[model samples]
Target: MATETPTSGSADGYYDFHDHDDAAHLHALGYQSEFKRDMSPWANFSLGFTYLSPVVGVYTVFAFALATGGPPMIWAFVLAGLGQLMVALIFSEVVAQFPVAGGVYPWARRLWGRKYAWMTGWVYIIALLVTISSVVYGAGPFIASVFGFTPSVDTTIACALGLLVLATIINFMGTSVLAKAAIIGFTAELVGALVVGAWLLIAHREQSITVLFDTFGTEGDSGSYLPAFAAAALIGVYQYYGFEACGDVAEEVKDPGRLIPKAMRQTIYIGGAAATFVCLALVLSVTDIGAVVSGEVTDPVSAVLEEAFGTVGARAVLVIVLLSFLSCAMSLQAAASRLLYSYGRDDMIMGSSLLKKFSPTRHIPPYALVVSAIVPAIIVIGSRVSENAITKIISFATLGMYLGFQMVILAALRARLKGWVPSGKYTLGAWGLPVNIIALVYGVIAMVNMAWPRTPDAAWYDNWIVALSGVIVVAVGLVYMAIHPLHDRSTAPYDDAIPKK
Candidate 1:
């Protein structure tokens, strides 16, 4: 166990080196300190919050949710919030024990074995890269609107690339700069959400709170509204992730076993509340709920913002939103690069030497960061090949992440059943088994709902894109593993992978 030392403050609120104790902990875990441990508790929490940015999540998916499930879609936030909160709990306990960089990958590696970890990381890293493209591409319209350009497909793509570049540059500056930017983004986003949601509810609410139960007949030709509600749950599914970002840089955080768990929980709780509040405000303030349900108001979130705050104020809010998007992308980029670094360190992938290289001054993986940026840039550029390419691919982002998360949850459950007790700064104790079971069940159900084909009139591929994407990604990963046998080469510890009876 690592003993906590007194934290000494610096000018930027980051702590000085007070804990060789943390370094000893890393050594005990079979790793050395290569990254700077400069992240304060607030910075750690901010990174998780920015990764799970409510503004980015709510603004990006609000219209779709409203159109797909009408005013009742707001309840999806409640369902997802509770469900993901359970996932956060499961993750917190695991991360408290592992506190390893690469989040799910290392957790899965220790909980199961390198083979399971490889698949989990492969699915997760691809999902994170695609999510970067999806988010920045989603931000294109907001960036265009802020710059007075008409929001079109072309302009959105171009602006998204530009934002991606900016985020990449920020990430290259090292952990301190990234932490500061995340703190700023978190403050702006949380404050802006509260202020905007309160204003809309108090000054511009056009419907009663009772409207939440009204579906406005979004069931379409379906027999039950449950189908439509399930489809609309995408918004909440997308919103609640990114909390795992906190654990992805475990080495860069001081006293991580204790801090990272709290950060993850804080992210799910605070980020989920912000998302639900904002979604509720937008739902209540919709000028025409029927129109939104009918798809006549395709951009209901912007409509509410524009109508309530007018053009100037809405543009200002766009600036804040742009910051949130940029912060979210940067955080994702950081997470991806750290996972790559962890893989490299373990010789779990090709080009292990280069991928594992850390900058002496920055204490960051420059090569891995570059790879992260380049892959997402390729994903964005490739997305333009079809008009709906990014849209179809983005559908897989949430589902892919859910799959990765559930893999860890399942591994943890397997470990528990094998008598693996969580011994860390934080543990659920008597509640661990029940919490783990519920989290896994909820995750699997959510995965099914997310991947279910809902669009009957669409192409077979389009309707099944989410599940198809997961299958393709997993298939490719399995092929690579079979050919290369990389997991067998991993140098990481796996004492937690107890043999089956």
Candidate 2:
């Protein structure tokens, strides 16, 4: 592995190295100071926020939720928000203790061992890459809507590829540009959510608040609203993620141990609020809620927005949504590249040397960034063969992330049971054990909810794809690990990074 002597301070003193505090912390955890630490607290927060991307998350899945469970689906946001807050809290505890890039991968490694960490990283990296594809594909129609063009499969694929290329360029520009773009995207999404939501509530609302409780007779095969509601809850499940992006870029953020945990919580708090408000506003503004539930109007959010605002007004909103999509793709790519870099830095993967190479001038992992972009672009192109490409791709992303999350949380729980105690500045104190258990429960429930085959009338693949895909991903990772075990396990020494009392 390449090594650099830890410097005492930056020339301008902008970094205030303080006896190489950050470098020391990283070295204690078996890593060198490879990434440039330019991210401020807000920048770190912005990366997580943009990855969550309320506008993109809600807009992309809005119509599907409305069609599945009608106005009552809005409550899914509330339930999901509470559930995910538990997961985020658990994440904060681990991230504060480890404060490593690649998020769950390194966390699991420290808590468990090499095999667990390998699977965690493998699943997470795949999820992050596919999430880039999902976000780009989700944005395609909004871009088309803004330009007044019809979104056919051909057009959507073209738009998705264009987005992948643009986001890759921003990532290659390095952390500073990525941070600035995240802040810009966050501002647009926040402002758009508040302004659009308030307008829809004040000027366009045609339904009562009570409307959110009505299922409109859309129950599942069991003839119970419970099953359909579980399926519809996917909207909220999908949105609350991406907060882990903060941990993925931990090495790039200043004072990460102190700041990343707070940033993770804030991402969920702010994102959950914005998403709930916007989804509620859209549901309430619908003139004919039955039409939406019955699939008479497939894209209910757009239909309502066009009706509430005039054509020009709706087009303006579409532009804001498009920006959110662009930023979402950018953040996903950035996080994925960092995960690749982390795996490579530890010599865990096949192309460690190349993947771990940092561009001296750019101070970023150029090859990893390129691989990140290419994989997602290929996924987008290949998805064109599927009739329900968007839904299935989104399912893959949500399932993959949940599986990765559960693995890390489970590892942490086991470690805790075995007398592990957090040594970070932000330990959860007396609440750690309870929170970790609850978080694991929520993760399991959410994963099953997302992977459950809900569409009985659709083709078998459409129904079972999420569960089957998840199994296939796990199997592939295990096969690779069995054939080619990691070259070195010396980093296991750093397990002492979290000292036992």
Candidate 3:
């Protein structure tokens, strides 16, 4: 491993590498290349694509988006895809400059300072863990459906626990296994989505493309469409995020500076297109759009699948969906463990030494993987209290991730304004600042839309739950930071300079 030393490079151009090795580039960013660089560009892209699983995202949120905003909600996929593509562009540049593990956390640390990174990591870690639980828990019913069992809370919890354990074991096998699993998951999801989507569009089309513009007046008492559309945007917002996971395992990917950017953007492009196609197919296949919009028909995705393909075919598809969920949970676990290892390696959190310890032979952080699994397992266990517990836990996840991404973006913008240009292989050139500004604006608006209190008639806390949960988490982090002061504890170099090419 190379010692932490700043490599000599021009401040205004692409960073120069000592050789073709990614380790030399990583060392320049102030860290040893600990993980084996075995992941190819395709594997890296697969990790992000699986993490941003179209099947899982579309199936999970389809009913809600349709019910809340009517058929027109399909446009949210397009809006979110374009907006998040901008964010992905910003991430590519940052990761190209400082392609360190922990993705947003390390990016923010280098671009701004430790405190900002600490907060960003804290929020993102929470979100990732919760999202793991959400994905597995969400997969429970599919598991039951595939196996021909009733999906009670107990069965669901049991299935979730089983999945959690399976994914954890896979993570313990190290990066190669994880990468291969992601690729398999990506293949299954893409193939399933394509076949199912084509089938639905061809033989099961119940509505025309013009129905996509029909709102069905789901705007409710507001007498306006924008609010409903904004609320419905969560479908796309949630689907587009897993792209950042590509950078989370920077040390494991070869030529991360250049390849990771391409991987990130590809995750968005390919993943977004897959999501939109699947969503459009499902939307067009719905037999009764008004019934769905008026809350009479729930679970439209499952309904359409079963109706179009019958029980046997739907179950086969459920098998694919379950695989997507498994891969998604595994990818999320990998990302969380890497971030924890990054923090631990930097001595930025409590139990730093333990979390930083990698499996000697496997070259993976065993302790950090365990920590990642344990937290989400506990969150899954919380389902005993109420099914809604999982809902509440996950409600803040998308918001937390967006918040973390914006922190990095905001940090980069701050550094840029202070005359720090991105010296990465993937710099946006003259368009960097304009792109950065627009990304930030779009992120803030999406966050507000997500955190906005849309459930007016429900209890106040329920209505304000998303915003309230985010505030509470941040406040808790603030209190913990004040007492422990983990911000200034990192020994890792926090400079923004990259090696000159």
Question: lDDT tens string, model 2, 1-501?
Answer: 111122222221112223437777676655677788988899899999999999888998988888887778878887878878877877777776677888888888888777878899899899889999999998888788888999999999999999889999999898989999999999989877899999999999999999888888889456789887887877988898989999999988877767888899899899989999999888889899888888888888778889988899999988888888989899998889888888888889898889989998778899899999999999999988998799889888999998998998898888888877665556677788898898899899889888888778988877899999999999999889888888345353334423356
lDDT of 1 by residue, 285-382 (tens): 99899987776777787778889999999889889889999999999999999999999999999888999999998878999999888888888887
Residue 493 alpha-carbon offset, candidate 2, angstroms: 4.4
Return the TM-score for each candidate structure. 0.94, 0.94, 0.95
Error of 3 at 319 (Å): 0.2
**Candidate 1 worst ten-residue window by lDDT:** 8-17
Pull out the clashing pairs in model 2: none
Superposition error at 246 for model 3 (Å):
0.9
Tell me how many clashing residue pairs each candidate has. Answer: 0, 0, 6
Q: What would the per-residue lDDT of candidate 3 be over residues 1-501, giving only the tens digit for each residue?
A: 111122337323235754556766666566677799888899999999999999988887888889988888888889999899989998888888788888988888888778888999999999999899889988987888889888888898899999999999998998888889989999999877898899999999999899988899888787889988988888888888899999999889887877888899889989989999999999999999889888899668778888998999999998999999999999999999999999898888889989999887898999999998999888888777853654465568899989988988888888888877676667788888898999999999989988988777989988899899899989999998899886686767674532223
What does the lDDT read for residue 388 in candidate 3?
61
Clashing pairs in 1: none
- Greater TM-score among 1 and 3 belongs to 3
Best by TM-score: 3
- Which whole-number lDDT from 0 to 100 does residue 410 have in model 2? 92
Q: RMSD per prediction, one decimal? A: 4.9, 5.2, 3.7
